[model samples]
Target: MTGKIVVITGAGGGLGRALSRRLASDGDTVVMLGRTLSKLEEVATGIGERAVPIACEITSPDSVRAAFAQIAETFGQIDALINNAGLFQPSTLLEASDELITDAVMTNLAGTAFCARAAIPLLKRGGHIINVTSESVAIPLPFLTIYQASKAGVENFTQMLNLELYDRGIRVSTVRAGTMVGEGMSAKIEPETMMRMFADAGKRGIDMMARGASSYESTVDAFRLILNSPADLYVPSVAFHGLPAGWTDAG
Candidate 1:
């Protein structure tokens, strides 16, 4: 993966920041795309010369197009794209507001599609696209109907993109991760709130072991695997830690 130009959406924070550092350290030129330029610059500073910050709003096509054009001009070409920008807001099917549902869909599903559309032309043969979705798509949890549906859309979109790009020698893969434990999680909500969400998730038979149990390192390893693998290799649709029944581990 040396010298390969990779574009990571939402590279400013959380999993995206971790992956940006990992890839940049491995000698890949990573373009950090996010809504906030300052945050992206913060991550880019840590990554040094290998990382470039590009402010982008994933939900807006104009924003994606402009960002990719800048990337093409600066880097000449893109070897891979990681559609990692996503939003998760818990909303039950019956109680979900239209705005909440729309926002989730726009960020998680439409955002990935918009980026992929802009990236395909820049990606030559043997390039790859990795969509960072969630395990919740498979094991739907309570109070997250909209979030689940948005990720489910990403999974389906990635599968179809893979088949569509097969003839062109481009591969598409997805990393459906479980609950990733990192600064992002801790920063988003307090411990008590997390406990309540976990308890509610448990009652829905959503498999807590697989739902909220992943370190940033583990998720980055999954990304590295996709990047280093051959074009024909396709990893599973989801990845997460396992907790046995009656197990109690929550902080």
Candidate 2:
């Protein structure tokens, strides 16, 4: 990974932060893009000189284009791009307002597409694009209709984009992640509320594995495999942690 320049959106926190740190530690120059400059700087500082912080709003094409311009100016080329910025809001169909659905689609699906469109020009041949999607797309669990729909859109986009970019030697892949339990995630929810939600979900046989449930290292390893593989090598259509029986069409 040495000397390779990689750009990761939402690189200030969550999985994005982990990938930035890991890639930087592996001697790859990581460009961290996020809406918050301070958060991005914090990640960059922790990663030493191998990381660069760039303020970007993936929902805005101009912001994404400008950020890529800065990256081009600083790094000269981008070898890979990871579209990891996304939002997750669970709402039942009856209670899901237009605002909720719109936000999910705009951020998770549209934002990913925008970033990929902006990065394609700068990405080198044989470079890779990785989109982080949720396993919800497969199960279609209740109360997460919007999130599932948005992620399903991402999956479709990734597949079609791979074909469109095939002639240019770029490859596209996605990580269909399950629950991840970790420190930062717990902070986002009240302990009691989170516990209650989990308990209720369990009663209904709907398990959210929580953040940090899967080691961050495993996700990074998958990223490395996708990036290091030959351009013609095909990764699985979807990579996920767990699934109920008959969830996939093969069953």
Candidate 3:
């Protein structure tokens, strides 16, 4: 209420946790939203009073509405909403189960839409929405058809949402991020699946072992920048990629 109030989804996860900490340190009141209360609280505890943990199952419309209602009551308005919650699993399209496809689409794509719809009423003029997408949508990777498709949908949603919100003075933007590593970051794919994905990527000229990854901490500042940009500056989207291992500047 006193400072900028920001809501970050998936705040229990690595990148989300990092962003929560970084934004709180910048004096914003960060609401950490995720499905797991314990995880959100763990991250919030480290940030002290500036951080608030709220359990939210983004894939559920009722859950999302309830969470935002709570947020509206507590803070009245939010300066920014960071759509960072997502699910990622490696499995061939043909082999992927129905649950996997449903979870992937609902969590990554529909969840984002649900949160945005709920947040619209609470976001005033000059409010910002930062939707996190992945570089995997553009870069080829095996066993990620669902993940890639969902994130691609997010990218498109960001663009169209920006147009819809333009008249309202609420800025919508997308952050297309590359591979990142951070504390508590883990992918729940079987070892064999991972091996197959790696081997397949290698055959396609992409080396997982040699690929570079950014620290989750390194990307948090970019969101801060987006939130603090001048009112006249409208950035529709921004992308970030890590340098490959042993890559050097020649010039």
Candidate with the greatest TM-score versus the true structure: 3
Q: Name the lDDT of candidate 1.
A: 0.82
Task: Indicate which candidate wins on lDDT.
Answer: 3
- The runs of at least 3 residues in candidate 3 whose Cα sits more than 4 Å from the true structure, single-residue gaps closed, are 245-251
lDDT by residue for model 3 over 57-110, one digit each (tens)? 999999999999999999889989999998988788999999999999999999
TM-score of 2: 0.86
lDDT of 2 at 57: 91
Ranking by TM-score: 3, 1, 2
lDDT winner, 2 or 3: 3
- lDDT per residue, candidate 1, 65-102, as tens digits? 99999988987778999998888766567766788788
- RMSD of candidate 3 to the true fold? 1.7
The sequence of per-residue lDDT tens digits that candidate 2 reaches over residues 163-238 is: 9999998888988887654333412544664665567667768665432246454567778777777766967454
Better of 2 and 3 by TM-score: 3
Candidate 2 has an lDDT of: 0.80
> Against the true structure, what is each candidate's TM-score?
0.88, 0.86, 0.95
Better of 1 and 3 by lDDT: 3
